[model samples]
Target: KESLDVIKVLTSKVRWITLLQRLTLKQLWVARNVSRVSIAIWKEKSQAVHQYCARWIYNSSIAFNAIDNDDFRLFCEALGQFGPGWQPPSQYQLREPLLNEEKKRTKEKLKHLEEEWETDGCSVMTDACTDMKRRSIMNLCVNSRGGTCFLGSKDSSKDSHTGEYIFEYIDKCIEEAGPLKVVQVVTDNATNNVAAAKLLKMKRPNIFWSGCAAHTVDLMLEGISKLPGIAKLIDQAKCLTIFIYAHHKTLDLMRSHTQKRDIVRPGATRFATCFLTLHSLYEKKALLKNMFGSDDWHECVHSKSVKGKASYETVMNIGFWSSMTLVLKIFSPLVKVLRLADGEKIPSLGFIYGEILVAKNSIKEATYQMERNYEPIIKIIDEKMKGRLDAP
Candidate 1:
C-alpha cells in the first residue's frame, strides 16, 4: 500500500498514465521498469520525450528567439540536473515542428476566442512597429473576456501601406475575429490609419472606431509646435541647450547657478521635449539671467562667443519670455488632460470628456477671456480632435 501510494504520487507528477498509453511497447517497457544501472542511457531519450511538449509551450508563450540563447538552455539544464521529474528541452525541439505545433494550438485558441466573442463582444487594436530588421510589421490583437491575445502579424514592407492597404488588413482581422462580435477597432491617429478607420466605420456602421487619445494629443502638440512664434522659441531653446552643453566651463557654471537641475529635460518625443525645455527655461529665468550677468560670466570666453551672444540675447529678450509664458498657459491645461489619459492607475474614460471641456475653458481663461488669442488655439485643438475621432 505504501509503495503503491508513492508510485501514484510520482506518476501523477509526470502524467505517467497518459504518457504510457501513448508510447510504443518497448518505450512503455522502458518507462515502466527501467533498470537503475541502465537508466543513464535512457536519460537523454526520456528527457526528449518529456521536454517536447514543454518546448512547444515555451515557443508559443514566449519569444521564438529565446531558444537560440545558450544561457537559457544552460539554465534549464541546470534545473533538470537539480530537479528529478523532468529534463531540459533540446533547441531542435523548439524549431519547425514546435512552430507547427504552436500554430495548431493557436487555431484551438482562436476557436475559444470566437466562442467568447459570441457571449461578449471584443475590441481589436492594430499597431505598426519596425522589427530588428527594420521591416514594418503590423500586429493585430483582440481584447476579449480572456484578455488581449495576439491574432496575427503582417509584414507591410512589400505593400503600399496606404489607407486602402491598411483597411484590407483591418478588414481581414475583423473577419477572422468574427465581424459580428467586434465592438470597436483602435489605432493610432496616423493619416492612413485614420482613413482606414473611416472606411471601416462606413463598412460596419455599428462598430465604433477609436483613435488613440495619446496620439491625438501628440498631434495637437505637433500643430502647436509648428506655430511661427513657437517654432522660433523652440529653435532658440535648442541653441541655448547646445551652447551650455558644448563648453564644459559654462556647463559647470550653469549647473551651479541652477543648483544642478538641467534646463532642458529629455522627453519621449521631439515636441514634448521642446515644450518641457521651454517650461524648464521659463521656470529658471532668474537663475539663467543672473548667470549671464554674473562677474564670472563676463570673464568666460564662451560668453563672448557668437553662440553665447545669441543665447544671451534670446534669454534677455522680454518678447521671448512673454511668448514662453503664453505658450505654457495655452498648453498646460491640455497637458494635464493628456497626462490623465496616459496614466494607467485609473481609467480616464470616466472623466476624459469633462476634462476636455474644462481644459478648453481654462485655455480661454488663460488668455484673459480674449477671443482673438484663445480662439485660434481652441480651433486648432478642435480640428485636431475631430480628425482623430476624439470629439464627442
Candidate 2:
C-alpha cells in the first residue's frame, strides 16, 4: 500500500513497475556475486589454515622435513578421527598432562629391554667431540638388545684428557647404567683413551674395555696414506686439485668436462678422504685427460703456469696411474671394512671378523696373489685388526 501511494506521485504506473523490475534484477546479480565471493574466501581461508599450522611448526623448531613423515600423516588422520567440533589441547594441557602421559608411554617402551639388559648385557659408548663453541664434550650412550640409548654429555673443557679424568667419567656412567648390566666399554684408540680403558679394567674386573673398530681402521688408512708411494700420489693430486679449484675459470672448465662430477671425494676421516679422492681421480682418468688436452684448457692462463704443466704431466704419467691402481686395490678392501664397522645395518658385530678375513683375501686377490706386493699392506692391517678382534 505504501509503495502504491508513493507510485501515485508518478504520472505513469508503468514507470514504477519498470523501476521495480530493474531493482529486482540488480539485487539478484548482487546475491549471485556475493555467493561466488564467499566461495573464493573459503578456499583462501582453507589454504591459510595450512600456512598457519606450518608457521607454528617453524616457530616451534620442528623439522620441516618431518611433514613428509608417515607418522605426521597418521597423526593428522588420527586427529580427524576425533571428528569436527573437537578443539586441540591447550598449551597448558600439552605442557602438563600430555607431556607427563608421553613420558610414561616412552618409559613403558623401554620396559621390554630390561630382560635383554639382564641377560646379554650392554656396552657403554663414550664419544668425545668438539662443539660449535670448540668446547670438548663427551657423550655417553649404551648399546644393547634394545639398541643405543643416549645417557647424556659432559663438558670437559677445563680438565686435561688424561686416563684418570676419563676413568672417573666412565666409572660414573657405568654406575648409572647399572654396573652388572654393562659388560664392556667402547671408545676411540687414542693414547689417553687406551690408558683410561686400562684403568677402567683394573677398577672393574667384571667389565672389559674395547677400542672403536672404525677408529682402528681409520688409523690403518692413515698409516697407508703416510706410505711413500701414497704420500707422493696424494701430494700430486692435491697440487692438481689446488691448481684447478683455486681458479674460477679452470674449476668451471674441469666441471664442464667431467659433467660436473667433483674429483674431491670427502670422507668421514682425513685419511679415508685421501683414498676416496684417489678413487674419484681414478674414475675420472679419461675425463681428466680430455680436460687437460682440450683447447679450452690450452687457452686458459693457468695452462701455461708451472702448476698447470705439472698437473698435466701427472695426469699423463703412466707411473702415477699404476701407483694409484695399486693403492686403490689395497685401500678399496679397507674402505669397505671401514664402512661396515661404522654402519649400523644388521648388527655388524658378528659379521666383522668374517668380513675382515674376506677383505684380506680380497686384498691378496687384488695383488694377484703376489706376497711381495701385499706384505707391507697386510702388516699394517694385522696391527690394526689385532686391536679390534682381540679386544672386548
Candidate 3:
C-alpha cells in the first residue's frame, strides 16, 4: 500500500517537473540575462523545495534516464531562474520550420526505395499458416534479383479459407506499397493460390505471375506418380524412405556395420521424391541398393516388380529425362530475363520485349521437346500394353 502511494506521488511530481521545464525554457528564450541575486533567491526558496521531489520523479520516469545535467541547467536558464555559475541554455530553434518537413523527406526516401524495387522486377511469395485461432497468408515482396522488400498478411475468419480473401489482402498490400508495378508473383500451386494468381493477372495485366519452381516440381512429381502402375511403386519407395527415417537407430546400426557409412538423415531424399530428390538418390544409389539388399528388406524389393514393367521402364526412359532437362533449360533463360529486368541499368523496352520473346521461345522449345519424347512412349504403350498401361 505504501509502495503504491509512493508511485502515485512520483507520477504527479514527474508531471509537475515536465510543466516547469517547459515554462522555464520559454522564459529563458525571451531573456538572455537575469540578475544572479534574484535567481539565487528563487533557486533557494522555490527550486530547492522542489529539488527532492524532482529527483524522485526523475528516477521514476523512463525518459528522465535520458536527460542530462546540462539539459536541466538549460531548463533553469529558459525559466530565467538559473543560479550563478550555470551556463546559458542551448538554442531550441530548428533549421527546418516544421516536423512535417522531416516526414516529407522520409516519404521521398520511401518512394526512392519503391522505385528501386519496381525496376528490379519484384516477385511476391505467399504461404499460409494456421495458429490456434486463425489462418493467415504471409505475403512477401521479393526482388527476383535479391532481397525481400515488404511483408504483409491476410487473415481468415470463421474458418473460411478462400482465394478471394487472400487476393483481397494482396490487393491491400499492393495499395499500401504501391505503384502496383511488379513482374511476377511466385506462389505454391494450391487452389487458393492459383485463383489469387489468376485474379491478380486480370487486375494487373502488366504483371507476370507464375507458380514457384519448387511448387511446379511438386505438381510434376504428383502427375507422374498418377500414371498407371506408377502409384504403387512410388508408394513403396515412400514407405521405404519413411521406414529408414522412422528406424533411425536400426539404420545407424546398418550404416556402422556393413557399409560403415553415415546414417541417412530424416527427410532424406527418396528415389521418387522430386527432380532434386531423384538427383540425390541417383548419387547415393549404391548406398540405397545396399540398404535394401538386407534380408529384412527383401519384401520391399520384391514388391517393386508388382508396380508393373511399364512404370519402371517409363521412369528409366529418355523421354522423362528429356522432359525434365527441357524444363530446367526453359527456367534458366527465364531466370536470366527476370534478373535483367530487376537491374538498375534499365534496358530499353525494345530490349526487354526481345528478352520476353526469347523466354517464350525457350518455353515453346521445352514443350516441343516434351511432346517429341512423349509421342514414342505413347505409341509404344498403345501397341504393346494396350489400355492397361499409360504414358507418364
Candidate 2 residues 60-79, lDDT tens each? 99988988999789988887
lDDT of each: 0.83, 0.86, 0.53
True-structure lDDT of candidate 3: 0.53
Candidate 1, 1-392: lDDT as tens digits: 99999998997978876776667777867766667646876897789855995688676897767667898789768877787776545788778777789889978987888789889999999999999999999999998777788888988898888998999899999898788899988889889998898898789988888887767777888887777776787788789989999999999999999999998887755666777888899999999999998999889998888998998898888998998898888778877777777777424443766787788999899889999877777887898878454532
Question: How does model 1 fare in lDDT?
Answer: 0.83
Better of 2 and 3 by lDDT: 2
Q: Residues 115-210, candidate 3, lDDT per residue (tens digit)?
A: 777676565666676667665546456454544555655555454557887777666766655545566566665778768877887898776656
Q: What residue pairs are clashing in model 2?
A: none
Assess candidate 2 and give its TM-score to the true structure. 0.79
Query: What TM-score fits each model?
Result: 0.70, 0.79, 0.42
Residue 290: error of model 3 in Å? 5.9
- The lowest-lDDT stretch of 10 consecutive residues in candidate 3 is 383-392
Candidate 2 segments whose C-alpha is farther than 4 A from its true place: 1-73, 84-97, 108-116
